[model samples]
Target: MVVAAVLASGLLLAGPALRRRYPVAWWLLCGFPVVAFRVVHTWRPLMAGCGLAVSRRPALTVVSGLVGKGAPPPQPRVPRRGLIRPTAGGFVLLVRLLPGQVPEHFVKAAPAMAENWQVHAVRVTSWKPGIVRIVASAADPLTDPRIPKQRGPGHLLRVTVGALETGAAWVVDLRRIPHWLIVGATRSGKSTLINALVAGLAPQAVALVGIDCKGGMELSLYEPRLSALATNREQAVRLLAALVDLTLDRMTLCRVARVRNIWGLADKERPVPVVVIVDEIAELFLVASRSEKDEAHAAGTALIRLAQLGAALGVFLVVAGQRVGSDLGPGVTALRAQLGGRVCHRVADPGTAEMALGDLNPDALKAAQAIAPEQAGTAVLASGDGWERARSHLITEAEAEAVAAEYAHLTPVLSELHVEAL
Candidate 1:
C-alpha cells in the first residue's frame, strides 16, 4: 500500500510533466484515464469517479502551479491570418470547411475559386469535417515557409507528417527498414520531398546515388553532394548495375563479419548504408520496342533484387514517380512488394490512389481518395510492421529545403562499390 501510494504520487506529478514535454504522447496518454474510468465503472461504480477525481487533482495542482490560473490557456490553433488582408493585394487564399460538409461541393467549387481568385493553387483541406485553404501569391515579400530558398535543403528533408498536430517531429529512423515507396501526382510535392530526403542524407555518413530520368533536372541541384548521378536510359541502367554490384559487396562484407542486422554491430564497425533515390520510375520500364526488352528486364530485375535483398546488405531505395501502375511495366507489382514503407499523397485519380494504398485497410483507401487537393503535403504513411495510420500534416517546400540545407554541410565522401564492372 505504501509503494502504491508512492507510485500514484509520482505518476500524478510526472504524468502532466511528460504530457507537457511530449504533446503527441499526451494524445495517446489522455485515453488511459478515460479507459481506466470505463473499466473501473463496470466493476466498482464509485471508484471510477473517485479515482479520476483523485488522480486529476494532483495533476491539475502541478500544472496550475507551473502556469498560474491567471495565465491564458494555450491556443489549440491560430486563425489563418496573413500579412496581407484577406481582401487585399495578391496573396494566397484558402477556404476551410467545418465537419460534415459535402465533399462534392468543394470538388466542384475548386476550379471556379482558382479562376475567380486568380489563385495559383486551390485545394480541399479536409472532408468529413470539411475545411479548405487556398494559396495565392502576395505582391509583397513571400512569408510562406514552403518556399525552398528560405529554409534551404536541410529543412525540406525528412518531415514528420504529424508535426503540426503532435507539435513534435521525428527523423524516421530509416535504418530500421531498408526501403520506401514515395508516390504522389506531378507537382504534388513529390520531387520537392525527394530533394528534402537527399539533403537530409547528404551530410550523413552514408553513400548516395541518384537516377534522375527527367534529364537530371530534379536531382542535379545537389551535384555538389551526390557521389553518383545517372540521367538517361543508359546511365540509369548503369547506375542500377553499380548499385547491385555494391549490394553484393556489402552482403559479402556482412557474411564475413557473421552479422545480420547492421545495428547489431558497433556504430564505428558497421558499414555505411547506401541510399538510392529513383525519380520518375517509368523511364526504366516504359520501353517502346521489343528489342529493348533485355535491357528493361535487366533493370527491373536489378530493382527487385535491391528491394528484396538490399536491406540486409545495408542498401536502401526511395522510389518516387507520378503514377505506379502495372500498365507502366511488368515489374511494377514485384517492386511494390519490397517497398513496405509506403507514403501516399493526393493523386489525380482514384486508381492511382488505390494503387498506392489499396493493400491496406478499406477505410484508409477511402481516406486517401477523400484527401483534399489543398492538402498536397499531407500523406498517409504506413510502417513495415503492417500497422498503418493516416497523417494530415502539410510539408511545405521551404520546410524541406531548410532540412536539406542543414545536412548539406556534412555531406559524406563518395566511395566506389567494390564489385566487378557492369
Candidate 2:
C-alpha cells in the first residue's frame, strides 16, 4: 500500500510536466477516456439544457393515456450522438441534430458545452445535412506547437509550414490553391513565413522568382536558388511583363499539345513550375508621381493577369505585404479576389484583416483581428473551404539561405526573366 501510494504521488507531481512536454500522449492516456465518459453521461441533459431537445406533443400523451391505460408519457427527444473519437489534442463526435435544430444551435451552445466538459474550447461545424460535428480540445494546441521535420523531398508545391489550431500540420499546397496573400505587420512573422516557404521550395525543381521592391533586401538571401530577382518598381514591372510572356508561351505550348493545362502534358515535355514571391505588395501600388503611377498600374495589371492564368500554366504567386487596403487602389482588391488563399497575421489596421478574409468568412476576420501582438506567426487562414488558426514554423534567414545554397544547382534558368538586363 505504501509503495502504491508513493507511485501515485509521483505521478501526480509529474502530470503537469508530462502534459506540457508530451501533450498528445498525455491527452490520449489521461484526458480522452474521462472526456468521452463525460460526453456520453451528460449528453441527454446537456442537449436538453441547451434547448436542443424537442418535447413530445401533449395531445399525443393524452391520446396514448386514453388508448393504453397507465402508459408513460413520451420524453423529449435528444439529438442522436455518435461514438466520441479521440484526436491528438481533442475529441470529435457527430450529432444528428433534432428537427428544427441547426448547426448554429450547436455553435451557439459550444461555450456552455466546453464549460461543462472542462475543456479548453469546442467548435461546431456542419458535417453534412442534419448532422453537426463537435470537436473539443482538452487544451489550446497553439501555445507551443511541435512540427515534425521533413524526412525527404515533399510533394511538389506542397510544404508543411506549421501547425494548425487543431494540432494538425498546416500545409500550404500551391497546386491545390494556386495563389496566396499573406499580410502581417513588422515582426509579425510575415517574413518568417516567407522564409519557411522559400526554404521548402528551394530543393524542388520549381523556379523561384522574387520581386522584393524594398531593394531586394529581403529576398537576396535566396539569390543562389532564385532564377530572377527584381529590386524596384521599374524592374518589377519589366519582370512581371516577362512572366506574362512566359505564361503565354506555356499556354501556346499547351494549345499545340492539345492539353488544357501544363500538368496534362508529358512530364518530359512539361515546363518547369514558376513561383513568384512578391514582398511588400503595397510598394507596387503606392506611387507618388506619374512615372511611378504608370509603373504601379503596369505591375498591378500584370499581377492580376498572372493570378488569373498562372495556375493552369504552372505559375504560382505568394504575395505578402505589411498593409493591403482598398485605398491602395481597385487593383489591390481585384488581386485579392483572385488570390483564393489568404493568411492574415497580427496587423496594425482592421482594414487589412477585413481585406484578407472579409469576403470569405466574417468569423475568420474576427479571429484574425483577435490575434495578439505577441503571437508572432499566429494567423487566420481562409480559402474556399473554410478558415482556421495556424502558426508558421520558424525558419531563420540563415537556414533559408543555407537551404537555397544547398539546392542552387537545381535552379532553372529562364533567360527571358533575367531582370539584370532590364
Candidate 3:
C-alpha cells in the first residue's frame, strides 16, 4: 500500500512533464483508459472526466422549478466508433462514420476533436468504404532520434526523407515526382535534411551533381562524391548546358530504340542516373546587371528543360533555398510550378510557404508557415494528393561528408553515360 501511494504520487507529479515532453507517447499510453472511459464509464477521476467529455449530455437538476442561471445547456456528443493505434508521431483511429456523415464532416470537426483530446492537431483521411483515419499528434516526430538510412533503391528512384505524422516512414520517388523544391529559413535544419538525403543515396549507383550558389561553401563539402560542382553563375550555366545535352542524348536513344524511357532498357544498356542538388536556387536565377541577364536567362531555360523532360531520362533535381519567391526572376514562377515535390520547413515569412505550397494546397501553406523554430527539420510535405506533417532525420554535415567519401567510387561520370550511339 505504501509503495502504491508513492508510485501514484510520482505519476501525478509527472503528468504535466510527460504531456509537455512526450505528448504523443503519453497520450498513446493513456489511450487504454481513455477508450475504456468512452465505453465503460469507469469511476476513477481521469476516467470520469474523459467519459464526461465523450458523453452526449450531462444530467441537469431543476432549481426553483427552472434551470439554474448561467448554466449552459448540454450539447449532443458526436457518435464515434473506432479504435486507436499508436503510430510513430501520433495515433490513427480507424473510425466508422455515422449515417448521413462523410469524411469531410469529420475534417471540419477536427479542431474540436483536437481540443477535446488535448492534442496539437488532427488530419482526416478516408481509409475505405465507411472507414476514416484520424491521425492525431502533439510532439515532433524527429524526436525518434534514429539516424536515417536507406536499405536500397526500390521500385523507383525512391529515397527516405523522413517519417510521416501517421508514424510511417515516408519515401519520395523521384521517378514519380522528378523535381523537388525545398524551402526553409536558416538554422531550420534545411542543411540537415539535405545531408540525410545525400547519406541515403551514397550507397546507390547514381551520379551526384551539385550547384551551390553560396560560393561552394555548402555543396563543396561533398566534393569527393560529386561528379560535377558549380559555385557561380558562369559555372552553373556551363554545367546546366552539359546536363541538358546529356538529357537530349538519352531522349534520342529512347526514341531510336522505341522505348518510352531510359528505365525501359536493360540495366547494362541504360544510361547512368543523375541527381542534381542545387543550394540557394534563387541565386542561380537572379541577375544584377544587364551583362549577366542573358546568361541568367539561358541558365534558367536549361533548368526548366531539365525538370520538364528529365523524369523519363533518369535526371532528377533537388533544389533548395532560404526562400523562393516569384520576384526572384522572370522564370522563377515557371520553374516553381514544374517542381512536383514540395517540402517547406520553418520559414521566415508566410509568403515563402505560400509560394512553396499554396498552389498545391492552401491548408498546407498554413501548416508550413506555422512551423516553429524549435521544430527544425519538421516540414509540411506536399504532393499531388495532399500534404502531411513530417520530420526529417537529423544527419550532421560531418556524417554526410564521411558517407560521401566512403562511397565516392560509386559516383558515375556524365561523359561516359553521354556516349554517341553506335
Candidate 4:
C-alpha cells in the first residue's frame, strides 16, 4: 500500500508538469503506475476517473454504451398485425389502418417515437384489423432496393446524391408529393443529391430551371437542360415572375379541365411537371442592408406563393441552404409549410439542424450531424411517407459528366414557349 501510494503520488505530482515538456516520457512514466495499480486492483475505477477527467473538456463523447454485460436480448416476439419486425437499428411496424382510418395518427407518432428510434412506414394492405403490411422503419434509406434508383435512365445527367441499387431498378412516382426541402451544411452532399434527382428526371419530359444565388456553380454544368439560371436579386426576381406566370397558365389549364391535381386527370391530358431547383436560399436574404424593401418583399412573396400553391399546379421546388433560421428572414417560415419532404445532412450548429428537420423528425437532425465527414454522401431523409437514415449515393464529378453525356441524346428540344418556364 505504501509503495502504491508513493507511486501514485509521484505520477500525480509530476505527470502534468512533465507532459508538455516531454510528452513521450510523460506517457511512458504515467503508464507504469497506471498499469501497476490496474494490475493490483479492479481497473474500472481508474478508467472511470480518467474518463471523467476527459469529459470535463469540450469534446464529443468518445465512449458509447457501457461495455459490461447487458440485459439479455428480448425474446423474439411474433409480429402483431400492423407491426413489422425490428431490425438491427430500427423497428418495422405494419399498420392495418385503411387510407382514412388514421392518417395523421401515424405521422404524429414520429416526433413522439423519434426519441428512441428512426421511423418509416409504407402501406401494404389493410384487409384485416390485426394485419397491416407496412414497412415502418429502416436502418438506412439507400439499403432498400425498392425505394428507387433514379428518376429516369438518362435524365438529370448529374447524380451528386443517391442512386438506384446496382441490380434493382425503380422510378419515383412523384404523383405522391409535390415539393421537397433539402438542407445540409456546405459540402455535405446536398447538391450531389439534387444532381441524382435531375439525372433521374432528365429522361422524363420535364422543364428544368435553377435559381443559384452563388453564381451558377451547382447547375451551370447542365446549362443545356436548364431553361433559366438565376444568379442574383434582379435575375431571381425575373425568374420567379416567369414561374408565377407559368403557374397561372397551368392553373388555367387545370381550371379549364376542372381537375384538382394533374395525376387526377388522364396522363395525356396532364401538363408535364415543371421543376425549379434553388440553391443557397440564404443569399436571397443576405443582400446589403441598403437594398430596397420592395425587391425583398417581391422575392419573398413569390417564393412563398410558389411554396404554397406551386405543388398543386404541377410545379415542384427543391430548395437547399445551410441555415433556415430568422437569419434568413420570415419568408422561410412560410415556405416551410409547403415543403413536405425533408432531407438533412451535417450542420455546424444543432439549431440549424433542428430548424431544418425538427418539423419532420427531431431525431434526424442529430443523426445527420452524427454522420462522419468521411461519409460525405450520406443524409437523413424524412417524408410524409416515413423517415429513413440513408446514405445519399456519392455522385462524383466524373459520374455526373458521364450521366450528362448519356442523357444528352435524350434531352428534349425546348419549345419557344418553354423559354419562360426556365
Best by lDDT: 2
TM-score of each predicted structure versus truth: 0.59, 0.93, 0.79, 0.62
**lDDT for each of the candidates?**
0.58, 0.92, 0.76, 0.60
lDDT of 2 by residue, 213-257 (tens): 999999999998999999999899999999999999999999999
**Between candidates 1 and 3, which one is better according to lDDT?**
3
Residues 1-422 of candidate 1 have per-residue lDDT tens digits of: 99988866776677778655653344344423443333233322222222211232355665785677565433222122222223222223233432334444555555454444444333333322434443332221111222222232343223332321112232345666568887888756566566655655665667677788789887767655566777776777777877788778777777777888665677787766678888888778887788577677878899999998887777788998878888877698889878877777777767766666787545457656666766655555565343232333343556545644655655555455321233
lDDT at 339, model 3? 93
**Between candidates 3 and 4, which one is better according to lDDT?**
3
Query: Model 4, 1-422: lDDT tens per residue?
Result: 99999987997898788865654366456633443333235223322332211133222222222224443332222222332343332234454442334434444434433322233323232334644443333223354322334434443222324422121122234446667777877887787777777766666677777788788877777666665677777688777877787788878888878888666678888766778888877777665666645666777788888877787887788888877775666777778777887777777677667777787765566567687766565677777655555555555676666666766655544343343444
Candidate 4's TM-score reads 0.62
RMSD of each: 17.1, 2.9, 6.3, 16.4
Worst 10 residues of 2 by lDDT: 57-66
Candidates, ranked, lDDT: 2, 3, 4, 1
Model 2, CA-based lDDT: 0.92
| lDDT score, candidate 4, position 362 | 55
